[model samples]
Target chain A: MTVLINSETRVVVQGITGREGSFHTKTMLNYGTKIVAGVTPGKGGSIVEGVPVYDSVKEALRRHPEIDTSIVFVPARYASEAVYEAIEAGLNLVVIITEGIPVHESMKFTRYAKLNNTVIVGPNCPGVISPGESKVGIMPGQVFSKGRVGIVSRSGTLTYEIAYAMTKAGIGQSTSIGIGGDPVLGTTFIDALEMFREDDGTDAVVLIGEIGGDMEERAARYIIEERYEKPVVAYIAGRTAPPGKRMGHAGAIISMGVGDAASKIKMLREAGVDVAELPSQIPGLLKKVLKK
Target chain B: MKLYEYEARNLFREQGIPVPEFRVVSTAEEALKAAEEIGGRLVVKAQVLVAGRGKAGGVKLAENPEEAYRYAKQMLGSEIKGELVKKVLISKAVDIDRELYLSIIVDRSIGAPVILSSPEGGVDIEELARSKPEKILKIFVDPVVGIREYHAREAARFLDLDEQTLKKAQQIVIDLYKVFEKYSCELAEINPLALTPEGSLVAIDAKIILDDNALYKYPEFSGEYVRDLSYYEAEAKKMNFSYVELDGNIGILCNGAGLTMATMDSVYILGGKPANFLDIGGGARADLVERAVSLLLKHPRTEVLFINILGGITRCDEVARGIVEAIKKTGVAKKMVVRLKGTNEEEGRRILEENGIYVLEEMDEAARKAVQLGGAI
Candidate 1:
């Protein structure tokens, strides 16, 4: 079974009335996601694309109690409250796409979700899009097709580029999850890698990392410890990032001296994962790994 | 996102943590008044954003009001780093018997906040960690459980602190954890948690870097960590552009900091001088691109404008639109060369073509075009 998501997954949108939430809801709907209901406090009576918008997650659940998964699209300030509300409603698979949710808020929600036995995808991520299984959040649906390659990335836009590159090179994704670029994110590369390793449909994996943070090194050790049989391709961004500048994401700072791209690339290479220098070379590298 | 020493100390005071008595003064008259109010030899420290004030001759001991005024007069408006010192912190200098280093930072390795303590203090911890790592003791706190009493005790005992001093150090560490979590701080450090002659531990210096995303919740807590830029400057900063006003002859624009810096270096590297380093990150929208270009062209010395964006999130087509929009909006006649890449490459090329603009994809080609245009000017 694929990890975290499946065909039976029922997902609801938290900030379903906002511009980003509304636009991405339509996209996710087009990808055949089992989007059940929408949540917005003041815009409860209104409907988006015929989906009923409830005043709260509890109200949404009263009409559709079968809702088990949730996708948050609220603003950064209110993202924590939205996540807590969804978890309180007994939803399991939570995916938060809000970019700037505070780390403290995230810690609280992640702590609660962990206590309640719920799997939270992202507070800053681009959400998970499983080809032909289920789709959630804002990934381009047209670019992805059902296939064997699994992807886990720190950066959102970079994931799209790599997925596009892979598709153009005749490779498709089993599931692509953007684990977020924040320093204190819920899920790391290791969690996603373990999922991909256990996933029967996933034949290969592509891990996209960035400079700053030691998540890549931890994943490298996990691969070596578990001795994953499937071929893996890895690429870490920000090789040319100015030494001390905190690039886009809050977590991209090289504070601990462990998350540098060169060191990560070295560790990944040592763990038998083929590393790609350029995004364009991902497909060629994946093809070579698949031949093994 | 990091607060100066005075700002962090104020935050510590608010959180019920003991900090040295201090007052912020912007002028020498105010500094002298503050020193008189404190009624003792005050430490007049230049309040710049960067650290190492002690090493930079920014921190001075003043025995009287005149000395304090003199120190403040000399330090204020003087450049400590690249930043000009606009304010000074005057605090009652503590009689110190010994100094210790205590800092609480989010350790990503364990996915939890960790407390770092060193008995050998008053120096750079990074340098200490390099020279004598054994003196530094680390205590990790579980995110769920938080910093336990035992955790504090271990840090205290590991640092070889005295029983009474250990209790104060323990409470200080606990209070730091509270501040770290309560404010969503990425880092809260007391560089020299000084043990005064009175046998009390006082936070002589403090540094806090509140999580940027958490700034909304901590608005009331906002004091001086903010970079003190104007509204437009702050917006430009949020957009990830490196903007510096320079006295030059050509306006240079490029994407990627490394590329932008190298572009300026190339302009200098090739004997053709550049005006400024303008880096519009890889994700600039049309509005941002237009704004950036317009801002660069605002300089009187900007005779020629060069726009370079290696689009990944910021597509070439959008950059082209931005350039066209800027031309329509501000009518910048500084002869410009635009370099664009990534998705919609052809679209960007066609847009620039239709608008009668010179577009190039290579950095050298774009730089050469700018040089040729500047030479013509």
Candidate 2:
């Protein structure tokens, strides 16, 4: 009943021998994710942290037909090709944790994933997690609790902060996904919202958004048009963020009002979603919305 | 990274795209010499990254070499749109029969490289798109297939060019696409692809924004393709921390993009302004945290240092070690508000508390403390 990943999900690690790949592989393993195989392109016939490493995603898939999900920690330049390999190998979901990928490369793989109907979590984002079931990506597992809230965001550390706040407030989450902060992303807000809407276990949703891109605006409109009945609580990150300033690797060049947090908050408010003024206010807002 | 006009011109010339015969000069005397060597009425254009330089008097037409020198002197060491005109490009001013606009940039809406062309160019393209949408023709080129001949032909036809000019324009469009890809540019634009009275198409002005992500692969752009960084920015660069200066009193040190921005917003919402934004990117150990905290304290306006660390891959205990080390090294007796949660939270809080640093468990409480300590000005 959980979306994207669960205990039944078998996994493979692309770039599993890399510093980041090998590091998160052990983390995912400790989180109780079924790490069945690893893909390192040329480093086959090897193993990382007791998991078999194949030379290619195809070979790994052959050895473990049950592997349905993959975590990609490939270097930024080679990230797109790795995602394509995962998609071509027929992995149902590909979670990319690498940051600073060129927008062009991100577009190519995201489009490929789309045309093939394979779900992608992020190229510059933290991956998704279903607490108490299975964990993927790099969010600290201790901060997440199994419940009805479906959390999605465009940030990594930010996701951890909110997830921690929720956990501290005794709120449990069904699934929390970081869709990435890049202007061109694999999964959009509407896409994640739709997935949560269909998942029977997700009773409410917490959307953590930031300034930059029109994804949040579009998501708000979609909520109104679809009349999504879930008690969605939203928290936008960059109210004082200067426009077009490169905040970080995840910084956005907001050309106009289209990408501003103000417009997004307005749209979400008009859509009848409870928008929290601060990240710390999110838990209370969600409780208020759920109680109503 | 914005390429200067002179650099873009050089790139165009190297690509065999027709550009006006030009020479770059740093001084008025050199400008006069170059203008005299060209032996014609010249254009004196300031070599800077900012836009609206033309209207800002950074661009001028000189009837003679002496006039070119006068213009250069007026421009060099002068500020246009907040960018100093360090160099001037002097070129033989061509007689224009027409002007056209062409640009190729990655468009998010299309999810591919897009070609935007307009016959009535040399003006603000955004305004043009807003007012006369019909004047602009946008073509979304397939990323895999790239800029095919037919896509260029489609763009040329949209510009209403004659058969011969259409062919020439088409080739130029294709060449521009190559430049975009070769240099890893996010945007390559020809503001006025001027058609001269001699029936020759020339790129009089060019703009290229090299993709920032691609900078690692193209290290040459550090001095060539970009402007000089501010003092703090350059220092922060060496420290491996993402720091941007702002006009405020509270200095923010945090991990993760979302958390840092949330901290900034929290400060503003609580009636405090952040002096700078610093993200010791995920997995920052003690040294980085110490270095970052020291950097934040270096700013004169920074009165209250707010440390917000939410541990995911970034351990709170490591951040605390950095904070304690920074306090020791910098000997900063200023007020600091620390919010540490997630992994190793208890250890991190204890480390800060043992060092006489004030710590708050809640973000709201930490922000309130920061604002209260920061006070007015």
Best by DockQ: 2
lDDT of 1 by residue, A1-292 (tens): 4567768888889999998788778877877888889999998989997788999999999999889888998988788888889888888778988877776667666777888887888877778988888888676666677788999987665676668768778898888988776777767788898888889988899998887878899999999999988888987776645455565566776663456677898999999998875565788999988887
Q: Each prediction's Cα lDDT score?
A: 0.77, 0.85
What TM-score does the first chain of candidate 1 have? Answer: 0.96
Q: Residue A199, candidate 2: how far off, in angstroms?
A: 2.0
lDDT of 2 by residue, B79-126 (tens): 998878889999999899999999998776556789999998888898
How would you class the docking of model 1? Answer: incorrect
List the pairs of residues colliding in candidate 2.
Answer: none
Candidate 2 i-RMS: 1.7
> What lDDT score goes with residue A61 in model 1?
92
C-alpha lDDT of residue B74 in model 2 = 91
Residue-level lDDT of model 1, residues B68-107, one tens digit each, is: 8899999998998667999999998899888888888877
DockQ of 1: 0.21
Chain B TM-scores across candidates: 0.80, 0.96
lDDT of 2 by residue, A158-178 (tens): 787788888889899999999
Q: iRMS of each prediction in angstroms?
A: 5.8, 1.7
